[model samples]
Target: ILLPLIFLEKHLKVEVESKSETKGNRNTSFGVKEGHYLVGNQGIYKVCKFLGEGSFGKVAKCTKLGSPGFCAIKIMKSDRAGLREMETMKRIKHLDPDKNHLVKMYECFSFQNMTCIVYEILEESLYNFFQKYEHHIHLCHIRVMAQQLLTALEAINSMGLIHCDIKMDNIMFIRQNCINVKLIDFGLALETKELTTVSRVQVTPFRAPEVILGLYPLDKSVDMWALGVVLASSYFGKYPFSYHTEYDTIRAMVQIFGVPEPEVLEKAEHTRGFFVLDYEDDDLCWRLQTPEEHEQITFSLTFSSGCWRSILKEELHQVKPSCDPREKPAPQENLEKTEAPHTDSDQAKMPIGVKKRKKVFSVKKDILLIGNLGNYKVSDVLGEGSFGKVFKCHKEETEDIYAIKILKYVSDAKKEVEVMELIRDLDPDKNNLIKFYEYFTHRNVNCVVYEMLHQRLYDYMHKPTHLCNIRSVAEQMFQALSALKSIGVVHGDIKLDNILFADKNSLRMKLIDFGLARKAKELVKGTKIQVTPFRAPEVILGLPLDESIDMWALGMVLACLAMVQIFGLPEEDLLTAGEFAGNFFTSDDGGNDPVFLDLLKRMLEVNPQKRIPPSQALAHDFITMRHLSGESAAEYFATAKTIMGSPSSSSSSNSSRTTNGNPQTPESKKLILWR
Candidate 1:
């Protein structure tokens, strides 16, 4: 989709183009000062500092004079100016401007004789973030940023407005160290019908020439070009064909990508003076010719960046594409994402001679020091929970994978720290526990790092047949339990999802999710600990608590897998709670394996005090004793019951006990674990 530079200009051309500002308001001085109150009497906005200067007027940082809330106000020098932007923003109002992905415009009013529009304040630009990495951004980081840019552009285009200028400077994150970006600086925005009136009001490096050439009528594709160039810059810090003059810019384009097709040349405006048809080499192609040769024929390419010659596109491509941010990313294979960026000294040697940009603003790769995290670069999100989300992060020094958990502000960090400390004391080398690597705070959020794992047991639950190596999995969980018990920590929430695979093929798993975990001594009176179905009878009945609760959930998890394996189905169909789970043990034929059935019964016994504990489970015949046929040990399923009965029964009855026959129905199933 990039058009070839068919006709190269031998020299720069002077033509009418969009100027940054008009001379009419050059001398008008709006006597506004920082800390001065605006006209709004109830909640006056006092100016903080000037943010930027634009064609309309100045954009200022302002605070609600009496409150801590911050907002931005864009001032129009005269009521007549910025009408286009005002109308465009009003149209966007109905599209839910408050969306975190879009910059929200609150309202407009007159302040000190200037038309002022107030909006939510956002941090520095994506351009600033790009600079922080010194243009050595990772493809993974660019993909995240680019995908969001595409989504935002889709939203803008859907509203039937062209954000005429789509560049890194206009895209920004809501938080200094976050990826949720929003589009800003809509000064040149226009509706489809009004584009002809403002043909050139866009940034030069990101310019789309088709519409600017004054040849074809432009459409949304023009903005797409700008988006492409912006993404292109995240790699090299400059557009591909960038040059000091419009003429040489085309030369740069021609150098990287050969001459364009003949059709592009014929339809292109200003072509008559710059290119000629070449038929001598057995093909008709457009070739760039010098002026003396151009004296016989013509065409031209143009853009407005004034200093772009030395950094050629090929020079950028020379940087390894593996890490280059412009290598059109492959779509994520699975929804499981866990990316983050930073550098940790303990993990790797620091890059040398990096000079700090002075009084720098918010940039993604700013040397964020979070406790033991040291220096690491963040990748993408793994998943999110009620508290916050987890990202795939790497130690800059070691280049190893780790997970970073970012949660909402902690009113008390003491509990989490205590919990982490106790675990380190119990399992310092993290043989069983998902190792806690580091913990730190960023502004209002708590960022903690942990050992990243392969995949979740819940994520692979459909592969009940794969879990046939029951002996291996059971041992692993017990190992994790031994560590938890040593620290007196109760992983009250244990289910398939909370268990992560060490090597999915090997069926090795580990216990996680200490969010609901508490030290046995710190358990609050009347505290509700376990999840549904997996909840031990004692926990549900408000009886005294202990580590026995986990044994019950573990029994249920293995039992569910047993049902799936025995029934030869991909997943379990029966999931009843409390008394309703009687069907589990009472099934007429639960795959008819009495030995495995008895072990589960003892594990799920009604009395927590009477239930099998972890140490005993380790010695139980099912875990320490028996070998699996590699087939599921059976218990409870309509299919299993039918298989053991007569053929007439299998044909006459519907085997599926899943909710209304839909296995994925929420009422019929609960994700044993999600994070």
Candidate 2:
């Protein structure tokens, strides 16, 4: 009788479980489990698993009874808040999801007193995707994602809605293998008209200035700002602003974008929270509050009291408000030159035959025709240097983009063109050299056209570089130098600004800016060459100069990548014969790989004849990673991660060492010479 009763209870439990799977369970608790059925108004779905959980509720992967594929069911704890999100979805339901790059909401229903919204399942969020992939997104892919996100924003804004929580996590890819993405998570979304000063929205790092400052009557621009942050984070593989606290974030914003306009600050209710009124030369202006003052007003300890304060103070000193040209007083020479020049009475007093020359005027046009080959329309200025300016231009006929370097003098341009002709036989892509297309004279300025590439290494590498990446860059640059050496040409300038990404996706770099390049035979002793920070010892000492100076500059570049310092040879006595071997490498000796140090020493040899050539440096153990203890090498590179001190501290330390007039140690010598 006991066995029969036990069997009967077991049979009843199995029957109840089967019933729950088919008919759906009426569990009101937040602990919904797998295999539980959710009975929606239009369909029934079986909970497969919980994908993620948040303060609001859990998102579960589910399969509809008759559906072909999986869907994500957002089971919200608060039915009222869930209903609000559903209403926002309904507002955008008329727009085509794929066309607008928005997440497709299939249906919404109440399941056991909880509001559940079913959305088409996506591969993953960008935040999760970036975790698995460690490199920064390519610019082309970033542009595609930006365009899709902008489309999504346009659609949402058309419906009078703002996705207050636009972030990496809120963006999802339609498929893992493709670039298609859609915007999701409208939980914090609100109508533009509904925004208030007290409405708390947005993740702190991506929060807009207007929102952070408690500016009332917000619009869709906040979402635009968040999208900009998202795109920046994607491109850089990290957030552009500080994520620690609101104060840090705002301070970074001020440092990068400058202080908000006076009119903008005047309207902000929280203006005084982050800024204070200050007088600069008797002119009133808004200045960023010191961290101490901010801490006193907010009663929040954001940073540690001791070391962080000094660091923050140094950073604050570097934060100068951007200059406004309209506010500047004219120079005395300019004021006198423009003082009612050549009035009619003064012109009449001139010599008899001297007539006022009709003021000849020249108009600069945006469109530049290149001798009937094509019309290049100039866009933004890519950069400006001692030579002249590089303008980003595209051919009007083919819309093909190119960087046109317009030289300041025709003679300088002729020399560059001559150097380019020497390498014309070699494949620019194969040789890792900038590809020159054509050179011509336009408006008395010599313009040399080349294939437009990505960013310069100087601006692109802001964070500490990885050893693997540094090695790759070193190898490519060596190959470039070898090619130039093969032709007896010396790259006079090989600084960070001269190297650019030929193909950023693959990290393929190319050497650029050959304005100072010349044949090896043309190098003259006592002639100043190379950037000051990268100038070789021989060049500074007025000794013999040759292609080996380029090797020295490349060595400096590698040291910069590894140790984050650029030791310039500014003083002649610093490189005097026996004094070059002081305690410079001793301070941070433990953090660097011995093999790398050996390579740097070889390349940076004070004797130009003994400097390692590009061929030999290419074969160095540091570049090849040959015969190295794998574990020790790994440890050294890992330790190298900490060697890059904050830029401000490094600059300050370098300045202090250089300004003192004592007999310089090798470290101080390096510091003084590089800058």
Candidate 3:
């Protein structure tokens, strides 16, 4: 058998040969000969060969009667192309392919009994590439790919849609001068705009445990979980959960990552018994059982290196009964005796238990105190706002200065002991936002720890004397926005107040005060408009604010930063003493800053329909100056390049072992890592 070469001839003349190496352990069939089939009655096209098949239909490399280059035609049954699926595909097609990582659909054709969609031909499937370069997949590579996928899903989700099927196979790679990947196959995509009351149906393998265990009408977060699995698989060179057959895969998902049983619920107060546990809350039950009973259960699940092992430790705790007298006895071993399980060299033994143990997350009760929450060691209070209080504090360890924001009664502080708990849980790229170190509350005082900053954009702007350069400030704000954009998050409040500078040169800034901050998926819950003066028109008009909102605020901040740079101070007409000033901090100079005026006009367009998105904002003549100067954003934010979109769920990837060396017992490993 002739093995297929990596490089193929441009002309589709000779018969293609199958490569001997099976990429990604995928099922391969190579006997079909190259031929042409009538797609519809419109025209005849030559079919070089079959590419692959999905639930949608067959995909093949075909050339039109008059066209020269090959195109990928995805043919589906015309009958299935209904209002729902077509609408999803249409939106996916219109998305900015250059900015969004979703596949670019050139066109869709429909005739009599067939529906065909054409796309730019990708050289190989992501799975194929993974198979080709399995060993070379690094955590950094996973971060880049995962970030791109997150951005794509963020766009889909922002539009209130969900991609039901996301996996290695559906991801395609565009390899040339740059590595651009596109998410393909939206046959299972569903519109979730009005799905609050409806149920969400999805595919397996890529499905989250919540979906598999009958969780309904899943949100865009389901895609987040799937992306997590894809990223984990790419890094570890295997799936987190895999089986011989689809049935086994489903069964394993339930048995291993499944929800807890009711009878096993003694002392499990903080977690919901019927739902899967989230690691973010520290209080959520990670393990279900006690130590002694953890040694008996024999079933084991496969473990790929880099897979979250801590969640497994929690699952073991749930299944094993604690030897502690207060806990119930371990569940009967009869069930395990009948089940066959997959095993690996590192697989832990399943714990046997009837009692559920309380899951612990990172947030705790005691608060750690830094300097005075209201007073800064170095400088007086620079600014205070509804979200938190900013004090210019000097670090005892680094001696490097930072402006620390002390927030009491954080938006959800009643339920969340610490604000950083949520931020840390999200695992965001910390560079864009001020880094929070610890949190402690003392007698009506809640202090959030952060790196100190030299001054705030607010202080720098209103100063009578010009200290640092303004263009440098714009560069910092843009860098922060770029970082936030990449993380699938929106900095709802991106004004002078929130932007804090680390040093007196005042060129670099970090976003602070996240009281009103939320994940990108949470659009409808909070107040639609944040800081109405500088708010985007869409937000002001009560339209759902996405990244465009950030861009809008970014535009205004850039303008203000520019004025501070050029005029040596903020225009008096724009500066206000109180926090309740109008949304747009404009000056009587009538938008006099020429460079900023042009930039802000585009960002503050009355219609979100017309407002510039982040990708476009980065391309704007004003902000692109840095890129034009041939500098990557990574130069400023050292960690920007390593940010993964988010963790799959609250579950930690690493699993801990028990005294008996059993992998499944709850009493074994301490589940320290969450998010």
Candidate 4:
């Protein structure tokens, strides 16, 4: 009995043999059946078993007659298609001989009137490898796979070819560990310079937005987009725009990436058919129209002036939680919930004009401006995650450096933008808030153009843990939260990381990451969005919250300063500080700064009733001892209105409409803080 070769032929460059390795007559059973023999250009291959089926054909395992090895043979339905893939393989193989991540095509031949494309036997497709593991490949390993996939794509690109259909299924693993994979199944591959034979290419979920939008003159960039989606899916354990249906893919795209540019919408062939202009906030959120609404929006039809506004208002009112009618519920219904993301199907009942955001995405790269609405050039990557990446960008014509965070989920970015607006209204001066110059949806990313400041307190902490002006820093935070309380804002996640230095000297700092902040009254009972270590006792104990939690986190921030002073690191941290709450910051122990300790005691109180609210903290001795910032909400508003001019003022005034349609703005926020 011939033991099937442990290895497979590496290349299609094979030599015909004079003698057959198999003893006598080669077993002739059937197509793709084990022990069946098939003749190729080089030798007779004994069929081992079936591998998998693809768009163009079925793949099966086979052993070469003269060679001591096994190989994969894809039997195509038609010779024309099979040879096309074979030619593509040959081009790719010739393009890069030194190294190729693509699966090697050993040989191709006809048997029983069917065309078969042969390849080295691969263990499994990347999709199957990941699915069997419950989509839990560590990013470290996936990174290696990504490098290999990119190399393969570059090889294909060098040959001026596009792997039109790039997905986990088309990427196969060479070995069981799955670190090294190969690009397989070029059945739908097309040369970049070839004439277009199809209107669109790529699988539904993995398809690029440009392809879906009909952004023509497609190039190898389309393949790059597919690679991004493929890598993102592996990293995130789901598609950046997790659409289960082809019809919903557009909606998913819009949701993941904010609405495309107006020009993109106007130029896109399918826009009219798929999306409708939602004018809820005087901004157009392109929501996929329902069957009836599709035709109306798809075709050029003059809309009744206020037809959308009324439908939008009705939809908004219906979605508003009825349990608490007065207080606007935090839009965090999707946040941290043990459920799937709200899908388009679930929102089908809502009016087309309803501003239900589509969950979709944009991968990195491309020289386009971020959020076509804003004029900025993205340059470098600052940070990255499954949801998004922070890019170093600057105003196109100016040196105004800014960090542009491109989020995968439009919901996350939209939520953050809402909180920023909420905070801005509350603290118009932005004295204690990250100064948001503008935010717009650019290239499907929630492009937030903020005043790029120095490193965060977390980064500064490394330089000198022994905070010199810890009280002064604490004073600014107290004021920020105090300003927030006056307007009913709660900074949900306050940590050293969220507290950033606003100036070069690290003298002034502001709070950021407002995406999680909720209204004090609207915060769901037991809702906890704070990082674990910074979580207040009330939040951890499942109690109701108020603006006091921010103060609690500030207390932890102060304690962290003290811990850093004493141990260079927070040993047990604030969570355990409650056990010795009374003497936690005592003079007898250190007396480092009695004023700071006094404030920490009240701020760290376990009882929400006992915790020092921002209002009283401003009047505390620790704050009055220092100089006030002198930037009152009134003065700041006056100066801001002056700088913004008439147009800005009008926009601000118009934007004052509340969630409940109230046109009245909140009273001027008056707060004092240490400079």
Model 3 weakest lDDT span, ten residues long: 339-348
Top-TM-score structure, candidate number: 2
- Write down the TM-score of every candidate: 0.41, 0.46, 0.37, 0.43
lDDT of 1 at 657: 21
Q: lDDT tens digits, residues 521-608, model 2? A: 9988887777676777787787777767876677567566645223223243443343542322222222223444354345323222
Backbone atom clashes (below 3 Å) for every candidate: 34, 5, 46, 12
Across 535-609, the per-residue lDDT of candidate 1 in tens digits comes to 666665666667667666665565544443333322233432445444233222222224333443443232223
- RMSD of each predicted structure: 26.9, 29.7, 27.6, 29.2
Best by lDDT: 2
Cα lDDT listed for each candidate: 0.53, 0.63, 0.47, 0.54
lDDT for each residue of candidate 4 in 574-602, tens digit (9 for 90 to 100): 42344553233311111112543354345
Pairing residues by index, what is the TM-score of model 2? Answer: 0.46
